[model samples]
Target: MAQPQPIPGTTIFDGIQAAKGYALNKMCFSFNDAGNRAAFKADEEGYMARFQLTAPQAEAIRKRDVLGLLAAGGNVYYLAKFAGILGLDVQDLGAAQTGMSKQDFKAMLVRANEQVIH
Candidate 1:
């Protein structure tokens, strides 16, 4: 099978990327449990260390930058779980990705949906 061509400024969540992101993904998945989320909030460093995240992944989590996390091998689905802990939703991440305010990104979503509907 041919490998998918890499997109500029994008991280493709291929098998290799998934392997690299395992620890980060595991940590994010733990957020599905409210107790784990509370534990992470109680001591972020301890939680990160428990997952053995790579340095870049740790930094991305610290900054709460969705793009950085994606670049560091985070899957969007898993990151969404993590974002919930920070009171952020996927729309916030979308806004950050597009360099727009949350309002603008939400508006873009609405426009796209309207186009599809019409």
Candidate 2:
């Protein structure tokens, strides 16, 4: 019998997929309704307050602080998407157990972004 292989872009951690789903849901919800989009756009401060992130955490995200997100238990793929939404670049953290380098993960992210746009 042959061992099963992971899907081309799947990560080992299930939590990472959950986090990405959650963020995508939030983004879609925010865009699907006029009121939601207005609320998000009208009060940037209050919009962030909804996440309940600490000041430093929010600041770190704003600064594209990959180290901080890692310290906060953020999944790198999800964090990259968050950084994308924030107009920031995702920095390479290192390699995964599957021998996928951080650069490979970033390229996967770019592909994911293209999928989202399409």
Candidate 3:
């Protein structure tokens, strides 16, 4: 059998990633609560310490590096909560993931939608 080709510029969220990101995901999930979001904003370092995040995960969070967080095994679903805490939305993440400016990313989305609709 031929070996499967991995998708370029994509991280497969498999068992290894799940295991590696358990702590980070858990911390992000906590952001679903308004109080938790406020707490994180008030004491970023202390909140991350409370979650016992790995060094890379903590650093990614500190830097607001969406791609780095994904590379460090963060699930986009969970990370959305974290993003919301930082006043970001899915469009911001999409732009970051594609390395496009927000305006360009939105334009691309419109173009793609037009293709599908027409």
Candidate 4:
């Protein structure tokens, strides 16, 4: 089956993207192990090299760019592990996505939930 046309401004986490992201995602997955997370923190470049990330993926990691990582074929759930290493939670990623401050994005989330309840 033909994969759908790429979405404008979005990198779909389809088979192709998954293939492209294998090394990157593998690296992120390692974060599940505390020792691996410490290794990453201890030597980021070395860690990325160990995973054999591509130039773009490694660049995204070096820049601490969530969006760039997504564009480089990172899956959000896996990327959260990477984010944790930087002391950023999923909410921080949400704020980045919405171009809002963390506080503002959190407020938006609360407001939206309240609307759904009332």
Candidate 5:
């Protein structure tokens, strides 16, 4: 797949602007805050449980491997949601957007969901 170039003037802030109605900033803030991180870590299993992911799916998330997460059936939207939660920058999002074909992206989402059921 041809890699996607960054959209000029685009930044994580742009993503935040695009996500105004989605509470993306709130999620990002929660994920970026040290206090929240500590709180999340305190009950990691429970938090992971909310995603209803299998062990390997959860493991993949812990590893922060985008391809692996995608291969395991995670939707890009949701993955993007998680990425936002992780404070992933727009550059990372652009890289992911550039990395695969549309069909491949759909397949990755299916695979990610399938893995979560295992």
Candidate 6:
């Protein structure tokens, strides 16, 4: 059987990625709790240490680099919690991922919505 072609600019969150992202995703999941979010805000380094995040994962979290987080195996769903802690929404993440200005990304979404509605 022929191997499936990988999608360009897309990372597949397979079993390996799930294992790799376990720590990071777990930490993000903790953000569901207000106290946990406050604790992370209070001591970013200490909180990451508690989660045992890898060097790259730690750096990505510190930098708030969405693409880097994804490359490090972060799932968008879990990352949403992290983004919430940073006062960002899914549209912000979409803009960052697409390399588009937030305004442009929002405009694109509006256009896409219009196409479907009309």
lDDT of each: 0.92, 0.54, 0.92, 0.89, 0.55, 0.93
Global fold similarity of model 5 (TM-score): 0.43
Model 6 bad stretches (over 4 Å): 1-4
lDDT of 3 by residue, 1-118 (tens): 6644777887778778999999999999998888999999999999999989999999999899999999888999999999998888999998998899989999999999999999
In model 2, state the lDDT of residue 112.
82
What C-alpha lDDT does candidate 5 achieve relative to the native structure? 0.55
Best by lDDT: 6
Instruction: Please give the ranking of all candidate structures by TM-score, highest first, separated by commas.
Output: 1, 3, 6, 4, 5, 2
Residue 8 of model 4 has an lDDT of 69
Deviation (Å) of 64 in candidate 1 = 1.2
For candidate 4, write residues 1-118 as lDDT tens digits: 7768965656678887898898899889989999999999899999999999999999999999888898888988899999998999999987876678999999999999999999
Tens-digit lDDT track for model 1 on 11-63?
Answer: 78888889889999999999999999999999999999999999999999999
lDDT score of model 1? 0.92
List the pairs of residues colliding in candidate 3.
none
The better candidate by TM-score, 2 or 5, is 5
Structural similarity to truth (TM-score) of each candidate: 0.91, 0.39, 0.91, 0.86, 0.43, 0.90
Flag the better candidate by TM-score, 4 or 5.
Answer: 4
Q: Which stretches in model 1 have alpha-carbon errors above 4 Å?
A: 1-5
Model 3: how far is 30 from its true place, Å?
Answer: 0.6
Error of 6 at 90 (Å): 0.6
Candidate 2 whole-model C-alpha lDDT, 0 to 1: 0.54
Better of 2 and 5 by lDDT: 5
Worst 10 residues of 2 by lDDT: 20-29
TM-score of 3: 0.91
